[model samples]
Target: MTETSPASALLEVTDLAVGFRTMDGQVQAVRNAGFSLGAGQTLAIVGESGSGKSTTAMAVIGLLPGNGKVTAGSIRFDGQELVGLAESKMRAIRGRSIGLVPQDPMSNLNPVTKIGTQVAETLLVHGMATSKDVDRKVVEVLTAAGLPDAAERAKQYPHEFSGGMRQRALIAIGLACRPRLLIADEPTSALDVTVQRTILDQIGRMTDELGTSVLLITHDLGLAAERAAELVVMHRGEVVETGPARQLLEDPQHPYTQSLVRAAPSVAAVRLSPGAFAAPASQRLHLAETEPGSGGAGPGGSAVAVATAAGPDGVPPEPAEQNYAKTPNIVELKDLSKVYRIRGKAGDFHAVRNVSLEIPRGRTVAIVGESGSGKTTTARMLLKLITPTSGSITFDGVDVASLEKKALRSFRQRVQPIFQDPYSSLDPMFTIERILEEPLKTYKRGDRAERAARVRELMEQVALPASMLRRYPAELSGGQRQRVAIARALALNPELIVCDEPVSALDVLVQAQILKLLGDLQRDLGLSYLFISHDLAVVRLISDYVCVMKDGELVEAATSEEVFQNPRHPYTRKLLASIPGNELNIDGELAS
Candidate 1:
């Protein structure tokens, strides 16, 4: 563990313990966790959900929920004891001395108020500015946080701003008073890579100018290693390891820390294969005509196809004249577009424009871009959820727009969707058994006994226990819930699955499990996928081919290896450069 002298430490936490009062009883959240940050230094606490990292940060900022409190330990800020500080005195220090940038900007910022009013409130409360000059100060703060046209933007409400713009507004409020310390909790978890990098860069510049220390809370190991100087690994309510960022991540001693490093796709030198984890050999799938030396070895010492290589002339080699190229196309989008006409807006808004792509049999093709880039719009059109303003969609040699009621019913049964939020995707009122059995009953596939047997088989396929069938969705963890979602998608044994940001909401370990499961299923059953996501690292891990989208246009489309190693488009290159920890070399290979 890295140590900081008390004299030089800006925030020192020792033997800290926190608990929340629940209806059943008092539940401990953080226990015996300790770390110290020197003045102007940055520290990060990283762990999965319910790991107490965020709880620790809340305790330090004296903003724990009404039911939560610090049960034991010491909190000293600049040599002043804060553990037992009075509420009035703590309020005085909360925003003026210690600032906060919360995780979800939409939930944290008031929806009804204008952006300028929210920012001005912070300055006025801290006595940073007077009424006559408060609006100017708000513009200056927003400008410093990298918001363009700050004066004009300040007149808008939170809902009117984009995700990145809202986050910048939060930062402007947090640093309006130039606090001595700042606490940022998963500030960019929901943002695209390029925007995440821009936000972090702005934070670095502002903090350096003000000489402010930072306490960052996040679940992304690559992000933590890139932004912070020191690392603190948190497990179930305890500190497992702490050290210098690069040293700790490269040579993690704790088993938990090592698992995190292995699960992180951003830092892995090679793509994770089915054999990389503990899966039965009978479950592994192999592709035909896989070239020699084109794949990576898994933990079981078996080669798995990861990426297709280019030829000697920097062009992708043509497929050999074989049955592999003869495989039929599963889904095709030809010049598809969607234009929404607003009630007041004069011009029509094109969400997706002239997007054409093909999903081959038993292969994964991914659509990747930032928010409002029309990736989701494309997926929705392919699903037949929305009618395209122009162009055509063909499914298995039949045009989708020509399908009637019965034909559409058959089409829905042949194709399935795995949505992003597991919590909302599954019905909370239904048991796991019922959730899995509903589709079987809908199709009249078999009797009650047969449906029961199929439900059990699905649970086994997703690696969930049959005992969980009796439980509700609320009883399962995030990973378990996602496994249930995947099982539901496979219930009908569809030929193609549309996974929309399936693993983006999950942590590294759980995300690895989901990706491995998807790969295994694709191999076991000749399933095709139309995957949509904003994470290029995840796209690298799971996709066979990649389509880069921007402002509703297809910027670049190529094999996964070609897109990452030889990006031809400027936007594609920018996205690659934005991935955190891309500069670090791990195990003799670049992290990106």
Candidate 2:
């Protein structure tokens, strides 16, 4: 274990003010952000998007984007000031004394190079290893980063690896030089909960073994509370709260922190009804005991299934799904399967295997799993993006697989898709109005004036300002972009919408708002959603039914209540177990 004491300040940042010169003007991205990390201590800077959590990290490392400059502040790393350090000196310290594991591995790494080569480059850049032994050291670090078959995996490119494996590769590179301090910026945000635990555990073990200090920047309060010792809550470029993680979580003084705690699905109280009260503490069951078909009774001792809901900071109780008992099936899949043949001598890959599911009209059915679990593939097939090798799909009793061009186009208007990454999904060159209007134009729903009217209507529906209609996708935040995507999906008034990880990329607050918006929209529009995501907690929030997938097969399928109360499959159980802060409740009590 590493020694972490208040007496030893490994990193001391004081009154840090950072700004960026944009087309609009100087935007103060980080203002008066100050925190101290004791030697071997883990400090988390938690905030929503545009809250300057990442800007502070970038300022410390001298890696701020173009036009970004430190306006005021003192960044002292090991008693040495680094605020005005030259590029050469900063480069020497970077990766040598301070390593960085960025948010997205795909963007951070070279796509054409092999994983081993990337790790070797880090070691070589910092002179950590000689040319003769770099290859061997690469494998060692990759293995230490928790990549299986490190020797062989090192030779493969990032494209060959899964999202988790690629992140592990980035971890290998980040820890290759064994730096004194590591800055992990949302390192596991894009990953599933199980893979997230593995990656975080690997970092913990490495940091402990090397006695390295960690600066964790993330939007996940639950993750920060569990992993970090000290927490600094930032909002609108200012630090709102800074103290012991447990203390802040249990008795938050700041309103923002309190809202964060309430919004967090892991710790939020289960809202039994719109204004329902929770059951007594005596009636609540432990996390381990709440499995599928566990017969966990609710407030009146009825057999009502329960789920977590948004309410005051209290113990999460089991809330029941919304009443959709009379709704008919909008989509039905029977024995759906998809197979693809590799170019090499290897056998075919079964992306989806004998999966059968139903999405009732005006109900949400969520598919939850890790990457390559065939969740997205199933959604793609449902959207008719790809033809499945076998099985049948019926959209409102019509065989979707047998649809011709005109009929397929008509089917598309009734069923739309909201992708995972809104930044990439929306066209960059087009204005928000154009982007939303394109769908109506393609479907030829109305004239230009009518389309513009619909665009304004969509803005109102998604709660975006009408002034934003002229703004481009680049100007919008992650949450805003997703809202635009949702608006575009709704432009056709589609009955069934395929939401693929729609809220996964957003911050917790934005995520909560988006979930609320979806729920509200579902109630108002009677919209049925085929929701696909890796986040089970979010699934439990908005989904009526839950389907757990693994290795291209449906491991478990049940009502969200049944799955949460009594998960039957081992894979489902593992996924539930892997939820961040699963062991800790809102009251900071550890599950016995």
Candidate 3:
């Protein structure tokens, strides 16, 4: 990578270290991490879940909670050491000299407040402008970030905006003061593929136009390779490799990087035949095995790799890259709808309208929508988590909503639900070993010894260590806890798993790893997943079929490529257009 412009270097992180003191052990989340970004430059810190990318970003902003501490480091923003600065003093620098685009908008944004007020508050805090001026600046920032009708939008609360727009609002606040440096931690993790692309591209362009430097923390190597000029690869809180993005992706120096690229799954070999979606999961898993030159890590952390010995799709190949590695009918909905009645003085509310669709087995179908858009409600109906108000919810030809308690529990074994937050899904009081084994015990599938063995196998399947089994959920990072959650979901060996925004909380790199794992599992075990997420980009990468929802209604559903390349639904199109990555114009918005 070229040198950060000596005079233009806006933020420099030198010899940074971060750790967490817990009862079980002291986890070194980051150690001796260093990087520099000049005006208009974007630097991406890429790594798997435990690599400490998020920890480093948190340290830069003095935001580590609990027992986590910045053991040693210098976060130099415009040559000012921010590590030891007082809260009030540091507060001045933040949003003015340095800004933050938080990972989770839900947590970062106040639910009850208007979006405009939040953005205005930032300006007010820095005393950059008067109330009137803050309002005008808020509108300008929102417009630049590509939100629709900035004036009207600013008045709406966080709950009103779509997932993509909410992200843009966060950026607006971060850039409200035109800070010299922007720290974005997994900014695109929860967005759809199209949205993910748009968000990054927008950031890329905005940084250039504003001459703002950026420190991007993500796990998505593909994204890092595409957007970042320089790449820093970390593993276990240590920097193992740092270099140009293209070089690292094309010819990674570290074994971990190399293995990650190999283990990733691709969309090129998606079932093209009439019976493609109907093929046994085993056959689909082995579909591309015999045809490839060299085998990489197979899906779901399973060791099996199969190929057909065919050429590369009879087309000139781009390159052998991307490490690692969905459907229509099993979960079908006809006139599916959900509504809730207000018990107080108010009346009934229609949360979900009439929706209809057929989900094929062995294919992934994503239900994307804003919060309260009936996406979660739909998932509940499918998994029988919550009975639909008035719709025929069929799973494997059975009307699940009509089932009794015992039968419903039995049906749950066939279709399990994976939650969005790793923090809440796991029982903090329960050991990881116990957490994983609970599902198996609930089902009484086998002997205690056999169940214990299954837990171990599952731990290996999710790429988690057996030793982690002794630890509690609080003892693990966001990614590890999520992995354990997946293992728990897999214990029943269900025919279908309802994954609800599973990777939204993880860093991009860890998100990719989880996506790769899900793909691997589908191939190895031929498991059918009913994946639900707001992230269209991940949906694009992993799903066979796409289902877009808005306000509890179906917007669109089609193949991955078809939907991404040409989205007919206006809402879906808006989501695609708002992605930050696609908004990137490498003309040096900052350099100019």
Clashes within 3 Å, all models in order: 0, 12, 61
Cα deviation at 288, candidate 1, in Å, is 21
Off by over 4 Å in 2: 1-7, 149-152, 267-326, 583-592
Q: Compared with the true structure, what per-residue lDDT tens digits does model 2 show for residues 333-391?
A: 87788999854437998898877777777777889888778998999999999999998
Give lDDT per model, in order: 0.81, 0.81, 0.71
Error (Å) of candidate 3 at residue 166 is 4.9
TM-score of 1: 0.84
The parts of candidate 3 lying over 4 Å away from their true place are 18-29, 64-73, 86-88, 110-117, 129-169, 260-329, 338-354, 366-377, 385-391, 437-466, 504-526, 533-544, 548-592
Task: Give the per-residue lDDT of model 3 (tens digit) for 177-230.
Answer: 777788888877666565466567777777778887888887665567678899
Better of 1 and 2 by TM-score: 2
Task: Write the number of the candidate with greater TM-score, choosing between 2 and 3.
Answer: 2
RMSD of each predicted structure: 7.0, 6.6, 9.6
The TM-score leader among the candidates is 2
Lowest lDDT 10-mer window, candidate 2?
A: 296-305
